[model samples]
Target: MEEQRALRPPWALVRGAGDGSGWPWRSTLLLTVFVQVGSHFAAHGQEGGRAGLDAFARVLLVLACGQLLWRLRRPVPVVFGTAGVTALYLGAGYPYGPVFLAVAVACFSAVVAGHRRAAWAAVGLLWAVHLLVAHWLYRWLPPSGDSAASWGQEAVIAAWVAAIVALAELARVRREQWERERAERAEAARRRADEERLRIARELHDVLAHSISVIHVQAGVGLALLDSDPEQARTALTTIKSASKEALGEVRQVLDTLRTPGDAPRAPAPGLDRLPELVEQAASAGLTVHLEGEAPRLPPGADLAAFRIVQEALTNVVRHSGSRHARVRLDPGDRTSLRLCIDDDGPATGADAGGGGNGLAGMRERAAALGGTIEAGPRPDGGFRVLAVLPLRGEEEVDR
Candidate 1:
């Protein structure tokens, strides 16, 4: 596949400063050619016998050579165009040593400007014509080791082609390297973006998921008593107030954990080590969420994991089951495993009983990230169950 290149913006003056083929090379090549040809002509007493232009040809040659400056902005076309003009000048018997040098340089520029194959093809065609030029020049030299004409005729072509070609190839490799670095940077940025998004999603789940579930439970209790009993309604109102304040505090804690301030100490994440309060609060809300377990003290991550499971299950009960009874069971396994299960007898079957879709998905993702698994489904008799088996040790221990 052809790799896409990011084109640099054109300079205010140079149309394609980094595009096509630009600057010094074009002018430098033409300059090398110009100096040689103009000086040689002047040495031969041509053009009024000075090292400069003729009244008419001087203006034209200077201008034509100056056009080499624009080759990068227009590479292939300038090359062909210069070659055509040089061919005409050669036909007119005007010496063009400098123009040939300029043409070779332009071909090199074409390669660096991202036309490597095209430039080589062009060199081939130009060399074919150059061979004809060579044949004509060779005819004048006698066959001898020291004959000046023999070497001079071919020396410039070989030297100039090799030097410029080497530089062009170097430029090609550098361009490829630059392209690779740019792609790696973009990929890194994409991965970081994905990571940040997942982090925000987890935080939202932790903070709002529990609090909303609590509010829902309290709201239901309040609504049930609003008409039937005023004293009971007042108690529900107090519960709502207390729940809201606590929720706000938990929200603050979660935000603090998620954020890094210019200055602030980071607290640890809440875990099931503090589950006594969570259980007591749920009981106050009227559901008897009896929890039983001899589970070992889990890792910090697993502690939070177990806590969230129970919290979510209790929330589901108050919101969907319409039942005031639920059970949470946690048991330690041999070595490095802990099994936790939360079940509720509620509405038994309803839209709300199916689990909070987004919340459940987030929980599963958290478990997966922690290298564990969870299973959730409706129980056979009634209600729903969430069974999660979290490995609490090193991969080696867990595997064993």
Candidate 2:
């Protein structure tokens, strides 16, 4: 039920009361009826000296209520107008009753519309005028032998006005808090969406870059040996077919994440267990991969980050480096972190080779998401080196 209300538009609670369109006919009619009918009962109970409900008194009540039709449209003026009309009715010695309802509603609307000072000023003006008429001016104003009102009665009236203003102020504060919360929720949702998009982009880049690089190298070998060595050409074609099929499967798995998010993947993600496959792929691409130290066991997130870091580093070497020899080394650092380094020998080919410079960036993002880091640059000796240090435990554990 709470979710349903949150999903609804902000104005659903108020309907169109604050839309500033046609008059709020239903509310206006209700107020008019309440004041007109309730005033007669109030006058009947008042002391004999007060004036009865005359036609002029009824007209003043109607006029005060009528100003409420424009309260949401021009709140400041409506509040003051209602206060002035009600003050006049009181000064005429008419018995006080539901007639103040109009002034309360107008002031409430004004404060809620961010015209708080104006609402307070109008209420203050009405209170001051009532005090003057009830005390100093009542002798000359109405009820031929009327006496000044008691100070205790004046105090009660002041308290009533304070209560109404306090209620309006409370409502205004709550509305602002609701609006602020809604904005924060909206911003958080957008940020989550942006992060999801980036995650999918990195997944696609890693899957396609390594596989396509293998296919590119294999296709070249097949074409070069097609006329001279048919058997070797067949082997190259076989490698191409295998590389393309694996790429498609990985791409499908990535897409499945988008299609049904939050579900376990149909196939487990690649990790250091697939290092041999990466080495074979590199060998097929005419690059020799020399595996050094064994990788330590890591959590799923860190495992995937480590695998991708290695894959992207190898892909960069196959595409950008002229040297065919490369080395991959793993360092189980102090039992808390897993570190891996990829190094290639000799000068770079200066070729981006269809990997749009996102390879290194993707690797870095993967490492960072796992509370790890990536360092990649040209080595002082020759070629390039990529070093990634990922925590052995989960991100939550690492934080602790």
TM-score for each candidate, following the candidate numbering: 0.67, 0.90
Question: Candidate 2 — which residues are off by over 4 angstroms?
Answer: 1-28, 47-49, 397-400
Clashes of each: 5, 0
lDDT of 2 by residue, 268-337 (tens): 9999999999899899889999998898888887888899899989998988889999999999969888
lDDT of 1 at 321: 68
Off by over 4 Å in 1: 1-73, 79-109, 137-170, 227-231, 250-266, 294-310, 331-334, 351-356, 393-400
| lDDT tens digits by residue: candidate 1, 101-219 | 55665665677677776666665556555565445643443222111224565577667666766776776676677678878989999997786678566656655666666666667
Error of 2 at 137 (Å): 2.2
Any residue pairs clashing in model 1, and if so which? Answer: 21-72, 22-72, 33-98, 321-346, 321-347
Report the CA-based lDDT of candidate 1 relative to the real structure.
Answer: 0.63
